[model samples]
Target: MHRIRLLTLILCAALAATLLTSVTARADAHPRETGRTVSGPGTPRAEVGLDPATGTPTLAVTRQGRTVLEPSPLGIVTERADLSTGLTLTGRTDREINEHYTTAAGKDRTRSVRMHEARFRFRSTATGARLDLTVRVSRDGVAYRYTLPATSGNVLGETSAFTLPGDAAAWLGAYRKDNENLFNGYGATAAPTGEYMMQGLFRTGSGDGADYALIAESDLSGSYAAAHLTHTAGSPTYGIKLWDGTPIQTSGTGTLTTPWRAVITGDLATVTQSTFTDDLAPASRVRDTSWIKPGKALWTWLAGGRAAGQSLEMQKGYVDYAAARHWPYTVVDAGWYFDPAQWDVTDPDWQQNSWIPELVRYGRERGVGIHVWIHHRDLDTPEEREQWLPTLEKWGVKGVKIDFMDSESQATFQWYDQILAATAAHHLLVNFHGSTIPKGLQRTWPQVMSFEGVNGEEKKTNTPQHLATLPFTRNVLGSMDFTPGAFHKPDRPNAGSDAGELGLTVLYESGIQNLSGKPGSYDARPVARTFLEQLPNAWDETRLLAGAPGESAVEARRSGSRWFIGGTYAGAARTAAVPLTIGHGTWLVETVTDTPAGLVRTPHVVRGGATLSVDVVANGGFAAVACRWYAGRTDC
Candidate 1:
């Protein structure tokens, strides 16, 4: 009887200890499992949990019961620990954020942002290293990032990936430093094994053409390099692949905050009109942005005027053209300071040059600003910028087009911030060329007018499908320096119609619309000039009325009381019925359409909410101007 009692006591003690260990483990892994699901302001939902089979952290998003993103993997890969697996969710927190602000450029003037945020803190069970995964879900999309504890370590890469539905359609572009790769359509599972650059758009549902998700990143500071997406053969997952560079290191003091790996979701209109990319970025760092003006400019490079390198006569002609058209600026492109006689001596003391200051003075007199191009290598460091930027500002140069950066590494990203800060100090606007896609930096620095990261007119291989894909993919992120409107130029053979070329002026949103046509080209096309004269670089409101990724695109933008509609179609000919949702009023409509004879302009009147039907030919386009009809006169 003593032996039996002793055995029973030992067994009971063992059972009690096992139960306590199990309870403690569960509590450490999921302290607040009940708050795993987060719902946005609308139908968007983000569910965070561990994969039962793999024991890895997972994130899934949905809209109106439709899966916008499949259960995607989420974790960080550090040098000292494998945080992707063997992780324990030590804690969790939730909150809501609401903000309203005005923007200097891009899709909307006034932005209202509301987001539901959740932070999941985890500890590596093996190494005991801590990481916090923060997620924010807005009405239009979902974004998340990893935050590491202040420890001296190197972040190798991310294990986070975007898993697409098997049947989803994707429009993606190959990774390029200039981001000038061509976008092509493909099945989600068949995405190229190579790599794809940012702002990729995917169609989640085939029904109603309403569901879409744009994959992008925001707040990409200097701590980490920009990453692209890579797919495995036959897999629906696109994993993160960082650019070749040094691993992100922490100094054991300040916490390392990674960029937000964002996936924007909703209907086509929601995807196109969404400022969620800008919403995810930091607020404007330049407090006094009043001097940062957005307007149209004349670019002489594409017009073969670069051959007249530094010629005062050639520049004055272009400046006079800008002044005549009421345009705000003229860009003096490359070769402005190149000593043609001494081709080897590339870097010269441009301040001592006579023509640049004269051109600046001449442009200022005619209400036109001069923007000069400088190679990124020339103004690379802080010392170089301090020496050159102040002199350029003193010379009355309004903005600088910094070109040939050609990098997306950590160092390059840091360089971009430094340059923007330096230019803001000098009160000069900026346009970035040979650069990565806009990671919502324009919102932080309003002086950053646009980025030449698209296969714009500079590339002759651009097609109608490429043009149609832009409003959905690239332009949605921010201003695109497309350098459009080069109609009737023999050397510049556009694949789309002349009317389509005209439509680009309104469709692509660039803070500075560098018109590519020379003076004679615009003079030759009167109808195109008429449309350009009224086009505004910045808009009060913008809407994607009707379209699809590659098949077609129609957009409407408003500036004050006037509204402009632009449409482009690929593949077969179709009559686009665009809903003019410019509020209640009689609108005086003037449209530039492609006809059997040539480009034609017609005038009529229509009530608001009426459908403006346009017959777009295969690879053709059209543009229209609508103003409130007040007592037989238009309020334009």
Candidate 2:
């Protein structure tokens, strides 16, 4: 029986995520199952106990008595919520969830894992409705969500909470204005009212060393709004708070299922690499995904200056440069439409419409695709947007960058979905700027290539610390458009080094790596040119070599047979090691390292697993590229 079960699990793991939507949407109130305790039967065990006294449920996780996650508060409640006084467990079920799926976007990959799931149904003695809390456990960590049947009051919001140890500090930054802030150290209890955005990392120390777990939401497709973390008073640790705008989201709605709130537990490395986001999300909804290609796009905004500004000639120069460098796409930013000097006035109709096609034709001749930039509210009506957007296909445009949509309301949330759907229909990829944190939307709609949710290089106030925090925070949510490549930014305030900027290119992930830097930045060095021009937009495997959340880090990412390694630092000089494991072919290695004098490049080769040492100065960088068969190959 055991062998047969193992074989069945292996076969199940080979397919994409296919399962019945368990705990189906319903309206009836579940009966109370007070004083019941259930243990998750798995390697990393999770035990949940319902307290009849307080009418609330608490969760505790352990690996052979080693506490992975301390007892934490677990439930969902809205503004009109309070069944805690009469909360009672009604039904309990223990089952196994075995599923697999292929990644549709972002770092392309596959997931095949098994886990145990426990569902606890409860009745609100006061509200007279049933609510269910469903939890999943595996080797990585635990994830759970609250399901409110229609019988309950209009479920508008959730205070879904997670309480951690007081001694432990969170790898959190400010939720800031638009979640574009850098993360740093803050005690789980010390975090002010609210500062952390999606995927908060909490690190704790026990007898041996430290443990890490990431907190965030996944599969936030339907009526759910984005979830943020806050400093709350009542807990063994910290709390998870979901932010809502005017006219509360999911309010008085039909059967409401909140996004999957997760606790990814392990070391900082395991916690960072866990596939909790894509793993919990559903498979691709679009059947035809051949047109969605993630690649590098040359952007004009970075080169837009008064001299030789956004004129047609300047755009042509950028196109020729992009084509010469082998970049796949070129972006005509906002300046192409409205005069930058006077935002209210528009360029001539011919310049806006006809010039675009002319530029597209110029680019098409040289094998470069064009992407147009548009504002969110410009083409508000269906007639305007539907008319203006599809016309791009005729001009050989590959995508559109929709900007300034700083909204999180239910209306705006749904509108985002609509824009993706519409663009996909037009066979154009999409990017959202001034946007919110991602929730696995790219995987669902691969055409929705990327978004700008980070405090990227455009801000003069951004520093190396800010970039350090991104990997664990904003980037963990999904592909972020923190346009990098400001190689000459040291002249400005709070600027990181040029070498650091190069490292950032390999660190940040996006379907369209629409970077912001001088057009001639990488032209001086053949090594720089080779690295930038040949960089793959997506990767098959990635390794987070060494990192301390918001401090210093190193990463090695692989696309096909090539490997790209980058290291970054903050405040002080540090040494990072790239653990290289090579086989199957001989390789050529090119490196760019930072020094007090300036940046330098060197070439070498290696046969097997050896740690490549990198010395990074304060706010500096280290980048290297290794590929088999690229030594004498022109295609490289």
Candidate 3:
């Protein structure tokens, strides 16, 4: 045993050394370019020059070799490289992007420019990786991105491409794939609207191969936004459509700076590991704020008892319940202001409703915050949106949950940026629902508290399978507002049990967590109430314990001296033993919250002096506690 322990220590040290060397080598390879004309107005044009030996292409801007954008072959397989065999690469120069001018509409004038861009197409074979890279100059700005076609035969996956930007916390956006109503559920079509971002794509299959794409876009300051429109997705879809019938599966964001870093691997563990080791650096500002106060846990009242009408009595009851249990906030979903039929931002009676002021005062007195819901369509017109901001602020609303931002056009993309900024200016928190996945936006605008771009609790009733499938695919991007903690059973018997709802509080990660059932539900479950009291919605440090896409996941989070861990399973029953390790201090066992059974009190024990392990079950998970031990431990 002693020899084995020594050997394990040596192996860990060696692995750490290798990782450091690789990171150092990468940093040394690419020194930041001193002075280059990266941004300016000119006739938009793009050209690609290939390096024959490496088979890598170099992107040139403005007919000069000023900035060399190099992309490596991502999904290369052992198959022969042919027109349609392996991943095929091609480039096109389109004049549509260069024609930019202004158009007049009556007395007002609007900018109308033909977007100039280049296209790179990647076609995958039965056994290899394929990718397409495109650079375009659009009216909004310039963009250099990539796309992976949905193939019929084998799958193609790609990774390890890098981008250089002026700053680490640059603006990034993604739209959810809008073709769900068309494809239903065959091959990556028609996923839940509120899940995964539209831009990032990840593919997996049983036929020994997978197809995927990694796209990166930068605004070049104020120059132009780039474009990379791949295959026409058959008809006019509501959101950004990338393929004919295929839908996007998974997506996320990471840092791209002087070292030029980003990597996408197959499984969840590999992806997290690569992101931490290769992509993540010492962020100038660590955004976790558990130190100031324990992050507040919220109870979302969207699909609960208030689904029908916006009743002040109903909202007051929910707030009273959350306040009784000490939960922080309660969210009043959409349909509260105008009639769902004639929903409009410019409506005079929008903020004139009686329930608005009633619920606000009721919540404030009881130490609870009220969050109002708004849709993206209502905020599309900038002038109109500005009018509503003051009203929301005057109402003393703590936050606003904006929904339905499902477009990837430059105009819609810019709209998202403006809304976040405006919300921040009002000193109000924002939660983007029915929107795209987050791309480090939380780091830039901390007030943009949470986002719902994952297939969350709403679909659990219709599609039971998605409840288990989403954590592995969509949850990795960032903090996912899954609207967890539902306390009701399915309407039908033998469909499944509703007992698994408690597991989600631990399973999902969000700065603003929503307990998704009526307040009465919490009154019935003593175990859940206890767990909610102890759980920390935000964290100081977060670690991926164990996981694989569409399988199972285990995560550990720390806020100050206390540590909490959560594990979950998608389809099948699974088990994972997680070690309790956070920093180098000694820890003591506190409590373990399990399923319907209840919490178990254990004797205090010391760890970090030794490795600790926890075991979990499938479709089910566990949340355990470990805190710093100051002196000799005793029985709890």
Best by lDDT: 1
TM-score of each: 0.92, 0.85, 0.59
Question: Candidate 2: minimum summed lDDT over ten consecutive residues — where?
Answer: 22-31
lDDT, candidate 1, 1-636, per-residue tens = 999999999999999999998776554344354467777558489888785555589899989998888889998887787788888777767778889988888878999999988788888777888888888999888999888877737888888899988888899998887899878899988876878887788888776745899999999877788988888768888898778645876676888989999988998888899888789999999999889899999998987666745688899988898999999999988887676553333346545645788999999999999999989998998877887799889999999999999989888888987998899999999999998878889888899999999998888677777888999999999999999888745433234477878888888998988999878888877888978998986899998878888878888899987888888888777777878777887888888887778778887687888888777777888888888786767435
Q: Least lDDT summed over 10 consecutive residues: which range in candidate 1?
A: 341-350
Best candidate (score: TM-score): 1
Q: Which of candidates 2 and 3 reaches a greater lDDT?
A: 2
* Whole-model lDDT, model 1: 0.84
lDDT of 3 by residue, 194-243 (tens): 22233333333322332122232222111111122222122111122222
Question: Model 2 TM-score?
Answer: 0.85
The best-first sequence of candidates by TM-score reads 1, 2, 3
What are the lDDT scores of the predictions, listed in order? Answer: 0.84, 0.69, 0.47
Q: Compose the digit string of candidate 2's lDDT tens values, residues 478-585.
A: 788877775645543224455666777788877788867677766644455666877886877767776676676666678888888776777776666666654445
Better of 1 and 3 by TM-score: 1
Report residue 143 deviation for candidate 3 (angstroms): 14
lDDT of 2 at 189: 70
